[model samples]
Target: MSEEQREAVLDEALDAAHVDAAFADQLFGVVDALDTSVALRRAVTDPAASEDRRSGLVHALFGPRVGEGVSGFVADAARRRWTTGRTFVEALEREAVRAQLRAADDDGTLEDTEDGLFRFARIVASDRDLRTALSDRVVPLEVRQRLVSDLLAERATPATLALARRAVAARNRTFDQTVEAYVDLAAAQKNRVVATVRVARPMTDEQRQRLRAALSRQAGRDVVVQEVVDPDVVGGVRVELGDEVLEGTVSAKLDEAKRLFD
Candidate 1:
């Protein structure tokens, strides 16, 4: 892949790895309700509208109950750029993740289940045909929801099934995103920042504790770490924090070295 494409993919991977659903949605219902708000969908989606002004309009549009954190993301993104219908998705995703993280906590009991949920999302996202089919707007919401339920039956949580339905009915986003939204919600309920860690081997308790401490400091909150072993990583550890990744694997370093000679 080209550098920009690779970077975008990495960003998505990191963001997906670091965040979860319940937290991502919170007041997100408000953002989704925008189209339902009024004829303003025309004003907000208008290509001619100034980005800053469209953003300002949202403050009066959604109200303080939209809350400060969600408002920050929506307002800022609007001020930054006028998004096309497709690009408007960018701001929504950002708001979702930020809101979710703010709601996460130390117990984070749902971390593993949430991880499983997103893993399923990535699996669906990898299949082009399946991804396209699930995201198709032409399909009736009821049909699409049933289709996803049949596809994931016995595999996804009941809650997950509901989210798939909602994404189709509400967001018009892909199935993968629906799964991701649920995971975000699960994580937010726990009130902790999700950290995906790739280690050369399973981490010892001490190792996990120290790592969590460092990450907690960086994130400004308790950090819940998920451990995955990648022997090919050779040595060191890699941690994904939000859109950033801290890579320290021996294989990665060696590959960098080889690239230098090439």
Candidate 2:
């Protein structure tokens, strides 16, 4: 299926608890069994076959392990029918992302992805050299990937790393989107609302703690925070929680004052 089609399938699963929980469990079972299906697994993973052939193999192999619904969904994936197991794994991985968001009881994992993506955008925007390399289409995937690995070493979690890899692989033209997607995925994993905050300077640990507590109270759940320090704020704090913005800065106050006078 096209990416649009695959996403549509995911949307279908997400829209129905009957799908996300029950059908997803079945998908998980079938993919897991693909390792053992021997003959059918090989065919489903083959690139030469038509979608019909692959779907047929999937039906034959996992019809027993999974329901008719899941087999149909798997067999319908156009990319998996033509691409390597890597793409299939990525699609499954995306489902796992959905599973996590479902488990966290968040709708679509938007806040989480937004927090991560915004931070990545800020990081890329702040560093010209890194941005140039990451966004360069001429840069081989291997090189860009290693750059991410080396940079993220000890800095980002394994989940974050995997997210970056997938995003970069899928959309190499914009690493910023990859970063955002990675963060959203992380939010799903942690079952927390992602709130990325910007400060003129690094926030004291106490300030971060206080912010987290306040956001949690407001959100009625634990909210994960990603701190970003941008000196241009000229000594103010800017907090972005989803679409909500809390601005506390002399500059903002001055701007407001100027607007009032004008």
Candidate 3:
């Protein structure tokens, strides 16, 4: 299916009244089932197979195991055309994460969850030992999950702790990468764009508000600025939003001048 079609399916699924953290966990369970079973994935995603057949297969396998809402959601998704079985599984995973974020939003903890995920990602990135312990497959999954709970249990909201532990699963990505994805999803849930702003010094509240307003105008959407005060930034601010980077730092200008001379 095209990206638009896939997004439509996700929107419809999430519209279910039962779309919450429990439903999200069930969707994740289905994703794990599909990810680990090639035959099951193929059977559900086969283009030649009739939609009824695929839907029936999904209902038969998961209907009893998951909630009625999740079973119906998965069955409906199976009836749709996906580019690949992997893509189908990924769509399910994405829906699961989005559902979790939506629940957090309902509880007014979405911002906390997003900030917690970003902060934890930064922590993991800066600490080699912690990163290794979390990312190393040799370290048991249970151990890694326990470590996540031990570190963030008291400090983070329930949604944040749940997502942080989920990141330890990693699947096809690193732990930090998974956490970053969760942060992005949380931002997207609020219909806002995320801007990672790097600067030499911390910005005052007024400065942050001004920059946020500017970015919101540029992107045509509300912007959430995640500030990173880095000594190397020298002066000015560098904003990273999705694929685009707005660079105005002294170091960036110096590099541009050096390249011109070369």
Candidate 4:
């Protein structure tokens, strides 16, 4: 199935499970099991197997091992059609992130988690050694997870830590990419889009509000502004919402003008 179809399936499971904070650990456990064993992943997600057979495989493997909610989720997931075992595993990971977001929302710290993740991503992006440590495949997974724990122990929420640790375990994406993806998912959970706005200086409250309103209208969704102070912008602002970047900075305009003259 396509990614959109897979997301739809996940949405169905999330709604049915009434996913809460506790489900995050359960989903993590499922992902770990799949990550550690190719056989188990294939057994549960095998397309040639009947849906009932797949459901049975989930029950045989995880029914006694996991909670009722987790078992139900596994069975439901196994019953869905996936193009590959890898995609099935990815579906579980997405569910885990979604559940964690739901839990954060329940605890009234969704925004905190969201901001903490973005801040950590920025920190990693700037620190070459730290990014190398987290992304190093030669390092043991336990060591990487410990590094994440030590860094975020007192500085971040439990949800942020959980998501960060899990991002390292992503099969197909780099650690930073996974964390950014998680941030995007968290923003979507809030029915908002993340707009990274670069400026020469911080905006006043009025300016921030007006900019958010304008971006919201442009994006056709509620916009959450992640402010970055960048002196190189010189003047005006550069707004990045996903792949579409609106570069209104003086430097960009000057470069355009220079190119035209050239």
How many clashing pairs in candidate 3?
Answer: 0
Q: Which candidate is the best by lDDT?
A: 3
lDDT of 4 by residue, 182-215 (tens): 8888899878999887776778787787778877
Q: How many backbone clashes does candidate 4 have?
A: 0
Kindly state the number of residue pairs that clash in model 1. 14
Query: In order, how many clashes per candidate?
Result: 14, 5, 0, 0
Give RMSD (Å) of candidate 1 vs. truth: 9.9
Per-candidate TM-score against the hidden true structure: 0.46, 0.54, 0.90, 0.90
- The lDDT values for all models are 0.57, 0.61, 0.83, 0.81
Q: Please provide, for model 2 over 30-119, each residue's C-alpha lDDT reduced to its tens digit, 9 standing for 90 to 100.
A: 655553445645567787777677777767766787777676666665324434564565576567455534533444544544454556
**Sort by TM-score, best first: what order?**
3, 4, 2, 1
Alpha-carbon deviation at 191 in model 1, angstroms:
2.6
- Could you tell me the TM-score of candidate 4? 0.90
lDDT of 4 at 193: 94
After superposition on all CA atoms, what RMSD does each candidate show versus the true structure? Answer: 9.9, 9.3, 4.4, 4.4
How would the candidate models be sorted by lDDT, starting from the highest? 3, 4, 2, 1
CA shift of 229, model 3, Å: 1.9
What tens-digit string does per-residue lDDT give for candidate 1 at 1-262? Answer: 3434433443344344433454356445655665454455556656577877777776666656555555644555455333354345544654454434333322343454466566657667767887777777787767876877787787754444445555555455556666665665565555666777767677778777777887788788877776666766533567776776767534443343223222
**58-133 per-residue lDDT for model 3 (tens digits):** 9999998999999888888888898889889988888888888888888899998899889988899888999999
